[model samples]
Target: NMIEDSEEDTHERYEVEILSKENRRIPAEMVVESIECRGEPGKLVIIRDLTREKQAEKELKDTQTFFEKIIDAIAEPVMVIENDFRVKLLNNAARELLPGNSETPFLCYKISHGRDTPCEGKEHPCPLVEVRNSGKPEVVEHVHQTNGKERYVEIVASPFFDSDGNFVGIIESMRDITERKHAEEAIKKYAKELEEVNRLKDTFLDIMHHDLLNPLGTAMGYLDLLMDTEDQEIKSELEVVNRNISRAIDLIESATRLSKLQSKNSLELEDINLREIVDRCIENFSYEASKAGMKIENRITQPISVKANKIIEEVFSNLISNAIKYASEGTKVIIEAEEKENSLRIKVKDFGKGIKDSSKQEIFERFRRKEKRSIKGSGLGLAIASRIVELHSGKIWVEDNPEGGAVFVVEIPKK
Candidate 1:
């Protein structure tokens, strides 16, 4: 083939194997030049050894294969992009999910975003640009479009360098975050809806305070004036009306307080003496307990301090009030406290009909009451107490009183 291709004053080259002086095979390149020497047809032949160049070429091909296999073995989509935005190499995952295979000269933006040029703008920032500017790794989110479908992906890009430590391009790994993006959008929508609901609840609470409580107060005052009569029957009927009106007022007040407490995420905490709060609550209910023929026992001794707000007093007030109201006449209501490693536990006990196990948890919810109609309550006392304890990073639960009634337990963190 070389001889046929060779012409006068032209050279043709061919790769051939030759025997060396030691009878060993060696690769050589043969160059033949046809010329007219003194009007006679002649040719000049030269041979150059190509063994070192062939070995170096094989080593380079092997190294490329090794790196390509390593990249292909990775699960996440990875690509090497040039500074000019042209994609240099990509793994199997990138080839499958992205546009333009390894055979094509494609731009990174073109392959991932299906754009005609490099990615720009705030919504789709170029990770290569960021890495080049910072000379560090960067994580950015980009919307990748493939086959008319869009998916969210988070790209971790690092400045890729050559063996000489010179910046060449960027190496990026892509993680699909389509599901996470959808979840975030859903959470944002739900948060907006919850905000609107909270606004409506505040409006309702305002109406309850001004519209409902004011009328009930006026009616109670009128009924009180009418109750000053000699007619015993009229007096009794008016007393019933007064009691019912008072109960309605209590119910509305309790609802408003509980709603306000539930809306707060945190509370102002202070170092409070637990005994003083319990003693004050007991004193407040002393008249009611005496009327019910109940004895209040302050079993708490040794000054105990807890990190809580003043509203914490309301929790003990509710528990003690419930104890006095529900216990049998002449029974004892015991208030005790204990200190643990990280929290303070208080128990308010009553010596009456104990709560059943099934109804214990339900009793802490709003408007949950005992089956007896004789008991008078707004039904929100325990629920209000529960919310206050929760806001103080405390816990409240009901247990059976060993002495025959219910025990309300409250756990408050020390710090």
Candidate 2:
């Protein structure tokens, strides 16, 4: 029980007693009284048991310490800036980057642009000022300086806020990408070298093919002469020989043209009427188309002019020849042209074996044949055609014909 008493002189006193379970009294250490309420004489006491609270506080401190260590261990430079563009905090990585010790606090005057004039004694400072003002990240690749050194860096900046949604600061992270840049450059160099090597190989193949044509012609002529005096059965055999020789000659000619077009040097470009060129190429192949029991249809609009090399003639010739070669007998090969804005688009459509989607992109690569065992080709035709188109600052691609076949489109700039 607790009791409060007031004397007649207006003085108040407070007393508290503790009792055990056995009903025995326990000693009281001290008590407090309210001076303002003498009549009530209220008593006040304090009791404390802080074991659990102390444990919770210790756990929280340990977690914070662990995270701080982790932040300091990061390899990339990390920093925090206030909304006012003031530097607030930075890690060890940032310290190594800045011109000061870790103990020194990062001030706006010390790290911003023009700081070198009064802070670090230099004409230019860092680029962080622009980043902070714009609130946007900045990226820079391999940059060579006047000191004969190169550096590649990517810096990302983002805004920060407090729990109450008040603008607090900004965070900036920086990473070095010099090694990656060097690797990419090395890959480019190797690719260039490989292209050059392929060109040289093509040149060698062209020379061999061209030299074989003369002997092949002579052999076919003698075979023809012999067929004039032989029996019917022997004459039939001579015809087979003549056919094979013609096929060989065609293959060699295609190879020679491919090699000449793939040379490292640029082609001689001249202004020519697109319709005239297409007509001439179609006329040249007219005899072969007629013999194959096929019709050649031209849908050219008119005097469309283009600045391209003479190789364009061969490009069209190969396409038309392939169409004629592969199309079913009596199928028509359509050659059409349209004038596009600033360019000319020519399409060659053949009712033949349509190229599969998976093989479309691969067809542009050298020596990639769909029917390798069955097709009689060096497989350089389409690859050479693609290269020729690219050299003319044009593009060539294949697509499926709506009805049932393949369509090859060639786009060249009119200028």
The candidate that achieves the highest TM-score relative to the unseen native structure? 1
Give per-model TM-scores.
0.86, 0.51
lDDT to native, each model: 0.88, 0.70
Candidate 1, overall lDDT? 0.88
lDDT, candidate 1, 1-415, per-residue tens: 6766678778788999999999999999999988778989889899999999999999999999999999999999998899888888899989877855456578888778667877777888899998998999998999877667778999999998889998889999999899999999999999999999989989998998889999899898888899999999999999888778888899889989889888799999989999999889999999989888889999998789988999999999988888777775527888899889999999998888988999999989988986646555789998999999999888999988776888889999999
Per-residue CA lDDT of candidate 2, range 140-223, in tens? 221323124455555566666689966566677767677887898999999999989988887777566767888998998899
Q: Kindly give the stretch of ten consecutive residues in candidate 1 with the minimal lDDT sum.
A: 369-378
Question: Against the true structure, whose lDDT is highest?
Answer: 1
Runs with alpha carbons beyond 4 Å of true place in candidate 2 = 1-91, 94-253, 367-378
RMSD, candidate 2, Å: 12.4
With a 3 Å backbone cut-off (N, CA, C), the pairs that clash in candidate 1 are: none
